[model samples]
Target: MTTTELAPETTGAPTRPGLTPAGLVTVLLGAALPIIDFFIVNVALPTIDADLHASTATLELVVAAYGIAYAVLLVVGGRLGDSFGRRRLFVTGLWLFTLTSLACGIAPTAGTLVVARAAQGAASALLLPQVLSIIQATTSGEKRSRALGLFGATGGISSVVGQLLGGGLVAADLWGTGWRPIFLVNVPIGLVVLVMARKLPESRAHNPLGVDRLGTALLAVTLLSLLIPLMEGRALGWPVWSIALLIVSPVAAVAFVHVERRLERNGGTPLLPPSVMRLPSVRRGLMVAVPFFGAFGSFMFVFAMTLQEGLHFGPLGAGGALTPLAVAYFTVSMLSSRLVARYGQKVVPLGGAITATGMVALLCTTLSAWPHVTILELAPSMVAIGVGNALAMTTLFRIVLSHVPTDLAGVGSGVMTTNQQTSLALGVATLGSLYAALSASLGSRDAFALVIGAVAVLAAIVAITGRRLPDPRA
Candidate 1:
């Protein structure tokens, strides 16, 4: 009769054979590890470069390489999970991620480390999409909402915690590994996950399906052409080839859309089905996710650089500043189910307002203490940002997946993850570059803080606008 009553009927199906609460936690943990790794290295980069004698350009490559690869392959990874079994791919991905982390830790040369990081990113691509699909397929109703909130919380907290943990490990220099501990630490955690995952259940489409090779290829090509130039073009002095590749992205993207539509018309399994785009909730949520995630990436990248290079903080001090944010994010995320269920879409706009206020606080802190602000000075802003992020992210995720039929769950998961990852890469490329370009003229400290504040404001705008979107059922 009403939305609340309808949700129970829709989501309350019998539990599958092995999909227990423990199993769901394991999947969420698996999802968090890779995301944590993604941002953890930011605070550790200076130490990594100094110890390995890596060139400045090579150091940038270390971060960009992993992210670019991870972003490019996420869609395909989701498809693989759909065609194969999510549990099988999840276990396989966990083992590979563990091995690659070991490789990264042991790598002697900068080149070797870069290669290992690329492998790690690839492994992550395989692992992350399955986490979402597993949750989507297994849980529903309050259970689904709670699980998704945890996933969102884990993602937000991982970015902050990764930096903090990286800093601590580098400072501790555990096992005489120096910067190596950052990567090595994942090995034991990953191994534990692998053992636990065996108890995880298998989940596939209700009906088996064929892989979409052409759609996958086109998606990869389109993303690569876009991110590669944006990440490296400036470092390479904007080479002719870089410009050419940048130009090719839109063309490739258009071609990808045409091909997918044509294939879908012919009764083919397009990587991204045209029909899904017609869903108002999925389409609008995605539009907001791109810019929102972009800002999140930029904030992490730029803030880490500021704390380290501009303020002369050590790795630990730089990372410690974000701890408050992480704690706040976790608290709010754990409580998100109650808030969202009651408030519905209103939760998103409120989050934006909160986040915008946090940015303002951060801006003030930077201006007042310019070259001497302590971690304590940044705490207020960090907490606000965390709370706001928890609210916006948890709500956005639910909206995106709300209308997905069980049959198309994998593709839905893939599309959402792709949007998030691509936007993250874009955030770092666009905002990081702008900060660098303005550093000399505006001064690094002032320019960095100003740029992040501006972007945060922009993100808040997008979030508020997202509140106007039609509900998923409509």
Candidate 2:
């Protein structure tokens, strides 16, 4: 569709409590919690394994289960929020996340923790979509754009903090609790958000669509079919069932699209509106988002293990290593919105190139340092990576949601978040699995560098694809 066609005229939708600044902070806190938990487990993996006497593959399951469950349920969660109420669903999700986190904290075994983590992921799925949907439905023009920028900043900052805090929490051993405090920390935070969230505005589609059970099931099936095999296949030594499931994934995805299309045609609500998928902004923005987030996930997972298991750093030492990245991401992200206003679509690919440059530096540094790699040696590259991440991340969300009709905010945000979460999970399952496999054969340093190289290549591709983004003036 033409730009003129895509930009729908504004309407005067009823607002609740004026979507106050305090309320926005509350929702962003809710956003930080889930994203934080997703990566926080990276540092704690070794501690959990030692504490529970779990196998390496089982530990992988601890991460994979949460990620997969989050990815699969995110879209449906968005649909529910759209149909019922955004504030209601967001609060409910936050409360459930708190309880599931507690379950993770006190779990007696790795299996129990894995189950609890999956529950936490589901709860996160419910909470995160609303942050963007609410912003999309309630705000517009520069305010909406800036809110989206902060969402991206919140995501990047949380990731860095998650890595940093996971190690800190593990090392502090609060009340001799070790890693338990990481999960337990959410309890008090959630309670506060629930209270503050009472002031947040509520909005939904004027003509809400009914839930599509068949499409939702098919989407779940499709994502699981792909993820289960990639994540578990390596651990199981490539079993037939894993290969079979991988083969079935594409078929499941096609079936899901057919179902969504049919639902839309029949005047029924689909899990994701097919019309949204056709938007140029979404199609192009994803080309950058997938690689950006996938590389990010792999970096966090690989670097945590490399620092602790390969280099023998202590928990705090490991977390401290990521501080540079956090600083750089926050610094650059704060500037990204202004840059976008000045540079428009060009800033995204430029950011990708810079990010890749950092990865390349990291690859060289890792190969040079080998087994004795230190945090100081990694700092410059980490800062570079952070810059790239901030620039691309801030604009990508705005680009994807730019043309979405206000009424479809929930579903649009759901689809956007689902892509991000799914890519993140895939990064762990695919690149993470690759790192693990190569670490066994190529040795730790070489394996880590090779993955960095792979990441750099992916970033370069994002830069090339990002040029296709619709012009801001359009």
How many pairs of residues collide in each model?
0, 0
lDDT of 1 by residue, 31-97 (tens): 8888678667888877887789875456656776677667667666766776788889888889889
For each candidate in turn, the TM-score is 0.87, 0.89
**Candidate number achieving the greatest lDDT relative to the actual structure:** 2
TM-score of 1: 0.87
Candidate 2 lDDT, tens digit per residue, 242-308? Answer: 9999989999999999999998998776777788878888777776789888887777778877888
Report lDDT (Cα) of residue 235, candidate 1: 65
The count of backbone overlaps in candidate 2 is 0
Error of 2 at 228 (Å): 1.5
In candidate 2, position 74 carries an lDDT of: 74
